[model samples]
Target: MINRRTFTALMAGTLAASGKSFAETARGKTVFYASVGTELFLYDVDAEAAALTRRSSVMLPAGVQYAWPHPSKRFFYVASSNGQPGGGAVNQGDKHYASAFRVDPATGALTPHGQTLALTARPIHISIDGGGGFAMIAYNDPSNLTVYRINADGTLGALVQQRAKPDIGIYSHQIRTTPSNKTAILVCRGNNPADGKGEDPGSLKVFGFNEGQLTNLASYAPGNGYGFGPRHLDFHPTLPFVYVSLERQNKLYTYGLQLDGTLSRDPLFMKDSLGEPNNRRAGQGAGTIHVHPNGRFVYQANRNSAVVDFQGKKVFAGGENNMAVWSIDQKTGEPTLIQTADGHANQLRTFGIDPSGRMLVAASISPILMREGNNVANLSAGLTVYRIGGDGKLSFVRKYDVDTSKGTQFWSGMVSLG
Candidate 1:
């Protein structure tokens, strides 16, 4: 029995089968990705598999650290984290720019659209609005967000609005929007544990976005006690629920949206039960969190178990290098641990819930490409397709490899297919 969603998805897929016009194929399409030491590779998703087919990559200009494909998919942007190692994060005095490139569908090569756009802080994050007319970005240094209007040709306009320091401590970790597309949330947290209190505390700030402008709607200073940082969030597809993934403390916080648009914190503060003395180590880093399409399950990736913060601080909460699963209560909009050790490090960085909510497409990151031999194996680069069992357990159905060995470390990042 084909449902409307699946039926609609098939017709949409057939029409945009060719990777010709990015605008036509970017929506509702899946793209495979692997992160090299400093580069990103993109592949068109295979019709019936998680494997990548049309391989393409774009170079991050010198000084840039990392970037992601814009939600719009018309352009790919990369942020220049630093000119040199430990360059003190691109402060305002510096350019702190974003590399804008035209995503070539034929070859997958990124063509420079123009000079880098000046950003308020280091470009750790960028996102497009629901209307697809504007972009908002979060900077790591000075901690700010800037708005840029999107041109019809996919180029970014001038920085229309620049928001600074909604929170007192830590840098801006991530900037994203609500499903309604009426508001945006900016989560603050420090990457390195370098603050007066030995821990950089952060806050979650919400803003009302209208006509390409941002207005301070409200904010919640969960206090430094919420643990190191709150970086990413996953919104339930059917419920007004959201899950926040913290980095410093390496914990998960759940929230329920109120009728007036305020987010209320959940009573249950869920933390991984992996390591007793948990610490922040890239090997055991809390990569990402997402709810299954059906809204009944939530999952997260753990990178390592050592000190995750560069300041030599232990993550202390989540330490194991595996995948963790939880059952989401629809009524209360909370999460309860269901499974752990689902996959390897960097595996959760990029994965997608199956359209039916019964499965997921997962990938792992390979850290060996840094000339860091396979012994330590920080990132386990591979692909896994898992279907959920009746008990909410994750079961592997099929797995894929980095088809081409040349691209050693194809660390997964974002997974989406139209």
Candidate 2:
């Protein structure tokens, strides 16, 4: 028997099958996309079945580092570079850029839309404002931020110049604007502890937003930002709270949003993201984070894809590789860990939940050699899909493997058909 959500999807598919224009399709239908190196792969997502079918792929100028969909849902911005992961350059030339693509409403096919803007450095993160009028980008190496105007034709325009400020924190990981479009926050994941080096402090740099111009507001951190390494953050859909993922410490923190466009000086709540918090392990850190669209749950990725040499063979270092599901207390904005679903693959770098809050897709970036008993083999990169339950839990549905020998699967996201 077809349930309500499935029934709605069937009706929408039926209308599209009956020759309805692609633009006329229901806006609730969703499709997923992943960036594997310089290639972009599109998928048709089934919300009820929690499945994905590969559609096609498109090529970009260089390797994809990050991507952001416009608020209009009709366009997407992709940042590409030749730089490889870790502390070195790939020497593919410094031809880094941010390109725009047109989204085909029905099939999720992408076509180049406008001129690709040359970027000064690799963009660690990029996001469009709530109003879809500006594209805000964050760079990591020598941290900086820039805002570009979204042209009337859905293209990108020149950068909006602003006064130089010394408050931009180190290693900016993500940048996002508030729903109210009055504030912008940059998540800076300061350096981790290294040999003969002390750990660098991290903080959330807040700015006052006015038509893409950012004015320094405040930097919120605990104990002068020491021992705090925030990588990503997501705002509640309806509440004045924010969920942040701490990369270096493998924890989650919640902050209250003040009306003056600043965050609480200290976290209102702090929770461990690991399944076994007491049993410490090496090569464990938090990745991307997303709040459920309905504001009832929060999800974060726990990754451990690093390998260690065992008996002269490079084998997977055992660590948690799963999605941590946390139930949100709507009244107070606190989160409780409810479930940790195995992501099937290692190192889930990024993931996305559908706008309707019914489906989730996770992308595992790279493959590593795993030891199964005495035999060892390479685990391929893949994407996992799950169905979100009413209680804010996740039920694993299926996994789609992709050959990452050519390039890594850096990022993936679900875009609703407009």
Candidate 3:
């Protein structure tokens, strides 16, 4: 068995030998961004201290849904829309856009790079291929995917029309390209049965990709995807393993990443994500899953924002709202639950880990009121920071409360400074 020090050294050496340009640029500084409504704010991160200092800000055309950085670390892509949840007459809104930004390597500031591409619907997630040649966007309402070329100058190019109508399952949440850049996976989180509606099965849509064009390859939906609702997935850094966060079931699934970019038909292992595995409640779900840079650990967010009417006011319905930490077995790629650290807020919609894997910052979407004995206390939306230990555990460091009156703290993530 490899020791912690030896494993870390090996991972570092492998990264150096790979000579990834982003790693070279990220050697010294780390920056973070958080979006509230149409404005995106930047922060400087001190990983050792587990603190964040607000820096600059930029505005998007609408509320920011998600963002991804180019492999070169010189550009960033953002998706924005005026749409709100609950599809039908509940305000679908009209405007949707995908914008590109040029990253200032030295200061980690952003400026508009290319013309914004108008999207047909609100983009739920956006990702760039490993080669940084194309940007893939996923829409939820109609469940669709779009590919746009990334210009040499790091600008958004025209959409690449696909001749194959791949089956994009219900409520697509995320789209990502495989490490080989030869295939892509779309995470479709089918809706759970509600209001006399039947359960819409979820699926992982795999496609063969070439020159920004995608062809249908495979769709993996165990048990016809009745109770499976995967929100996000992350690949192991050095192992042929993929970890998926099941949003609806509050579970973590491990799958083998095949040579051809398809996943194993059945999960290799599955584990409960919640600390109280038996106490499942409405609105209790998993948000994101990410593997540590050293490949020794995986982290996921468990969120619960369910509310109940009490004394003519909405009050927090207690449930799990924290980060679930898992220790990965290096040899077999199995994960064991180790810790469930408190998030200290409601609706942890997103979070980011520093490139060095020394710190993690989670963002809560909005404030919530919880009944404490006879009185109610307000839990404000904020950015919670934690210090990562050598054993892949997290220690609570500090939290910076954010003002979300203007809009929810919708999205936040870390980006290595180039």
Give the candidates in order of lDDT, highest first. Answer: 3, 2, 1
lDDT of 1 by residue, 268-370 (tens): 4556634332444444456667776556778876554333332333222234655678888756666877777456333345565544345555665442221
The TM-score ranking, best first, is 3, 2, 1
Best by TM-score: 3
Per-residue alpha-carbon lDDT of model 2 for 1-418, expressed as tens digits? 2235543453343333234333343346688899888999998887777888898988999889888888778999998887655432444347779999998988889999989999988788899987799999888876788999999889999899887563679788899987567889999988877878887789999999888889988898786778899999998765677899999888999987766657887898999999988864788899999988777899999998667887688898898899999999866788999998998998999999877788899999988889988888878789988999999888888888888888899989888777
Among these predicted structures, which one has the highest lDDT? Answer: 3
lDDT of 3 by residue, 268-334 (tens): 8999999999988888999988888778999999999999988777999889999999999987689
lDDT of 1: 0.59
* Alpha-carbon lDDT, every model: 0.59, 0.84, 0.88
Tell me each candidate's TM-score.
0.72, 0.91, 0.94
Off by over 4 Å in 3: 1-26
CA lDDT, candidate 1, residue 324: 71
* Steric clash pairs (candidate 2): none
